[model samples]
Target: MNPTQKMSLQAIDLVGPSQPLVSLIINNYNYAAFLAEAIDSCLNQTYPRIEVIVVDDGSQDGSPQIIESYGAKIIPVLKANGGQASAMNSGFSVSAGEIVIFLDADDYLIPNAVETIVARWQPETAQLHYRLTVVNTEGEAVGFCPSPGVQLATGTVWPILLKRGRYHSNVTSGNAFSRSALDKVLPIPETDFRIAADGYLVGAVPFWGSVAAIEEPLGCYRQHSSNAWSNSQSTEDPQKLVKRLRWALKHDLHRYYWIQHQAKALGHPTQENLGLRDYMHLIDRLASLRLDPEQHPFASDASAGIARKGIGAVWQQDCLSTGRKLALLGWFAIAGFMPSLFATPTIEWFLLPTSRPQFIQKTIRGIKSLRVA
Candidate 1:
């Protein structure tokens, strides 16, 4: 037997037979170079009851051949070039396990990852969010993404999820979902979100049931040039940066709009989640500000309304600290009054207080380097 297979067998021998079955669905496109490592990671997990499935989204690379090499070890589903959402839906349609993890082709699990996840899962838990170590393309560990900072005091977390945006404290590869939760959320709405399908699921699942969390790093998230988020960070050109910012702003606005729609459909109180209401109002105000007050008659009054009620509402909430509420108000005021300010790196510094100073400094250095060249 090959070394990987033998190691997997050894690990399986250590796991108890009574463990619940977990499905690891690896979604891939052209990431052939990293595919095997991801699959091997799943195969080598200490948890014995796992079914590995690879869904190939019409990759032109040798990913199909690499998947074929696994043979009977993993189930392979090949389909036409659909986006990540489509691949996810295709994978979920065939999964039979009680727990499911949508593993990215570029990310892989730690040795005892699955075991840790299963151990922490409760019958009432709809999803479990675990920590993940961040790595570069070379597979060297960089840092870790932590679990949600706000403690979930109750069984239902829809209120907290709406208060904090969907992307906050969430890593797609670091989550495991109960089959029942997946049943409620899926088949994923591919048309609404062709990419970032996890964002949709993360936003929706909390409403269905409870969520648990594990702070220990259980997987590795590789950031590279090909990753969508990484691509925006790797550039320093002013025009490109501005374009990326606009795209991100619009994307976030779209996500918030979708969330608002979904929450209404699910009969959740969108008003009680002051953060959501504030964000929606802020986005609307910004959109209005982009046009002339004469052209958009409501622009001036709406912006003023948000600055009062929307910002005031969030500031009154107990969930956010004084500093966070101040920051939120500042962000909305600046973005509403001077939307062009975001075109510069200043917006990054304003919104992300932790890392944006370094980002802004790096961006300035890159601009200087271009001038020198």
Candidate 2:
């Protein structure tokens, strides 16, 4: 049964009594200024059975105090600074709800966002999935954005999922899933890496069970100066972006290897996870580097045979490998991973018009030429 059917059944049980439960997990860090707005957005949800969890990863800033201002209504889990993944993990650790949703500290939720999303969640199953509505700082419909295994293009998720693959390579954090679906994929690895944990998690979920999608803007995406992957990311040093990409790759590789091992240990199939060839590939790549086994984190005997394939497996599956893939990967490794170097060209390429006037005339002519036949 889907969320609507489940809600309908529940409504029948209630005989016009009460509402279903929804747990909203907010992963907060140091954004004290924007914290209240994020929290308030949830508080104002049209759905009344919503429980809010604000996990604070030791903000030296006064974010903790801001959360405290909410008193008991907003459950606040305070902890030492543990990157975003750890903070998110902590948030889920304490959530008690049929479904789970994430609201970042810097972003606010649209009014009735929770109600809209929960309406689509299927309470009859252990898992639920849905598409999200992406909005800018102003509440207007700007365009679609990407999330793990989910992307928004004029309010559609199917095209991106089918074309891009199960894991959303671009964005994934602000999506909704059944708590049961989450428990199976919980405790996102506590890596020192600062990005891409959400992407890795999305990739891992398909193996768990029936994943689903819905077309609606479930929340508001705040685009501002302090967001981790902000609009200004294009202006950053190319080296920093490259470093971030490499780290993301490493983290994803680690998850793939681990999932592969878990599958083999349970005597299940390995196609969904890593394979023997995948482990071998990792070994050969490390050998090519000739790094001292004692010095590198990936050199341990335990980690050695994790995946046996070379770059072939990774590159083959990576869809982002357009013509520019190699050069971009090169930037990540050789050119200090500069984001600007890659972005400037991309921006210019997209902005350039072959012949603006001609294109406009053709477009107008085509529209005018449309006929009933």
lDDT of each: 0.71, 0.55
Badly placed stretches (over 4 Å) of model 1 are: 1-17, 146-155, 162-167, 249-266, 269-345, 348-373
- Tens digits of per-residue lDDT, candidate 2, 208-304, equal 5544554555556666656655542433353444333344345646756545543454465545433223422343333222222343334343322
Q: State every prediction's TM-score relative to the real structure.
A: 0.74, 0.63
Evaluate residue 73 in candidate 1 and report its C-alpha lDDT on the 0 to 100 scale.
Answer: 97
Backbone clash total for model 1 is 0
lDDT minimum window of 10 residues, candidate 2: 347-356
What TM-score should be assigned to candidate 2? 0.63
Q: lDDT, candidate 2, residue 299?
A: 39
Clashing pairs in 1: none
The prediction achieving the highest TM-score against the true structure is 1
Show the lowest summed lDDT stretch of 10 residues, model 1. Answer: 364-373
